[model samples]
Target: MREQLQELLEQRVLQCVSMPRNQLHECPGIELKKQSCAKRSAEIVKAKANGRIKRKFENQENESVLYEVHFQYLIKQRGLFYMEEEVEKRQVEFYKGILVSDEKLNEIDGPREDVEDIPVFSGHEEGQERKGFRYDRMKAVQYAERWWNDFNPAYKKFEVDCTNYISQCLHAGGGPMRGYPNRSNGWWMQNNNWSFSWTVANAMRWYLPGSKFGLRGRAVDSAEQLKLGDVICYDFQGDGRFDHTTIVTGHDGNGMPLVNAHTYNSRMRYWAYEDSTAYTPNIKYKFITITDDSDA
Candidate 1:
């Protein structure tokens, strides 16, 4: 019976992935359906037996394939009338019809210089003015701690709030907003609208260093070099696409950055997330240091 059940479980997973895209609506047990989003969802549908399957969609022409599987099964105990449950999980990834390599998966997107020219900062008193503002690390860290869980009424909340939360922390630390009405550049937020850099993880990565004024940061060599209030970006799959961001709030005993983040509502957690499902061996990171705080 156990063998038969195991075979059936495998069959169900196959069926779930093989079902026609149009027929997806008929299968309510499937938790996630977005073709463009790089997320996988699954669940168990039997008594004392649980199963989960995850898959990624590349493009409209490609079929989604099972990438991961998790299952819990009941096993008979030695000389006992009761049964014991055993859990198992498996991960598989393929790229271009070949297995992916850790080195290839860890490759991150390099810095770009295609952003709008940085406005020159003119050092002038009252009558004269500078175009960019400085960043306050202390104020940013304070703001992060203050609103680790609470939502700020001024900004629009997103289903994925990591980048939005980081932007607020940067703004609180005195990062000035530029290009107010324009969404192509700057870090300003008005009503439900905001600059792409202000709310998107990948965009912020490019905007910070590219901007000569307002919010500016330089890339650092290591995570340990980061001070309190520094920012870190994560590329979970290392496909040059950054999907998450976090703020440094504290440090561990070994001096690792302890971070605070939204979306999962974590506070002062360890920076290296080896336990996360999104975590990959090829994970890439970007450490940013806000350089100029003269205005702050």
Candidate 2:
């Protein structure tokens, strides 16, 4: 019975996580989807000579173009979420829900097939219904830990500098790089001259030329349009200079966006988008977008 239970868990690990095959983190992975703007586009309205309105045949094409980055998220398997109810239930079921061991439940020295009460969780439900909801702050932090674990230590120590570390976290989350080379740029290369593009600004720019990874780059406006893995760069001085980069993890309870960034004060932390009061004084322009360099 015990052996059978172990096998079930192993299978659950594959279905819920699906990491090794997809290059996804076992804990949480970022996903992107299109979000449209609520406000009508300027092209949709026509101004009359007398300030009167007129209906013009503006195509739906412009409506689709009026999208902005409004949603950000980090998705994970439902089974991995630390639900006390589920945990206790599984323990009880595993031990046959009694103080004295029940040989009947473990007749084959493994889990019993009759343990139907055990919670079965999945990331997505049937017909595209989402099984798991947005993870919370604590889960996001845990996801960061999983992300740290998945990073190759050799690459982390040798190829990544301080700025590159921040960039790498964002890259793993889904922000793609551009100008970064995978080979032979001694200063930026490691592991046989594979140098990583460094700094938040430089790393943001790296996607301009595209890399070996298959990453696609697109310019977007507003944090709301961003998905969990999108990269957001800020021109802190509003002088057309992008000085900072951060990765969007997901949304908070109030629909405020959350971001993960490093090196500003040395530790990676989540920042809320609505709390502009903290850094709005220095922020000039905010550009959020999704880039995919996986092809390179």
Candidate 3:
């Protein structure tokens, strides 16, 4: 079942990549549109099975299964005469399911839904200082701006190091670690090992809101509301699967957030990320307001 689902997703990705601009408007289950910009190219970064659900058929030998796959890709564009290139990161969810027959599968409604609304996190208690220590935001931003290009030798680095770098900045700014020895929960790093929240984008999404004592964050409505030392998470595919993270270091003259990130190593870059190939019209964002223990 998993293999079949994977094959189906791969085929859809190929279709999106090969379909011409004229035909993209007519393609089913695919979204392609021309931007105001010129030049064009496409690339798939990765795809993976995230989860599954099974429903039993009454008195039947078989069951219905729904599989969720996360797909990440990039689209690049340039002017007709200009050599400069801009890339947008994109992600989309593909659902593959098996029923009694192809007819039954065809009867499923909508097959997919728009990006799920971000879960709401409760506000901090009135006048109550949060538990744990606080780090200096200026220091965290300094670290991010200073080390985005240089690797910190203290921790292990991966080819995809965005989340790891963000975690370091948050720590430097005084976010405390919890749930040590349990990689599935908490945010901690010791001896080259770290929690999933410290290293994975999706895990950190849940961790920040669910945390009670360490590394808590309050969700804001938009990027404009985020302050320096805050964080932004991206779901290029709008599938509720966050794949990238960045730290706010400064705001532009227009008060737009400017961020620093690793993996691609950007410094004081614009937060909108319109230049990334992974970007899409359906992109989703999470603006996090890091809570400090010193606030009362």
TM-score of each: 0.56, 0.37, 0.57
How many steric overlaps does candidate 1 have?
A: 0
For candidate 2, the clash count comes to: 40
lDDT string for model 3 (203-238, tens) is 777778677665788899988898889999887778
Best by TM-score: 3
Q: What's the ranking of the predictions by TM-score, best on top?
A: 3, 1, 2
Cα-based lDDT at residue 273, candidate 1: 57
CA lDDT, every model vs. true structure = 0.60, 0.33, 0.62
Tens digits of lDDT, candidate 1, 15-57: 6545666776543333232231112121222323333344445
Q: What is the per-residue lDDT of model 2 for residues 1-296, given as tens digits with 9 covering 90 to 100? A: 33444444445334433334344333221100100110111010111110111122233322111111111122222222110000000221222322222111110112211222222111122343222122232433344435432343545442213235444554444332222243212113333443323432544344423332333345566656656655566554455545455555555333434555432211122333222222445565444454432312
Cα deviation of 63 in candidate 2 (Å)?
63
- What is the lDDT for 79 in model 3? 17
> How close to the true structure is residue 83 of candidate 3, measured as C-alpha lDDT?
16
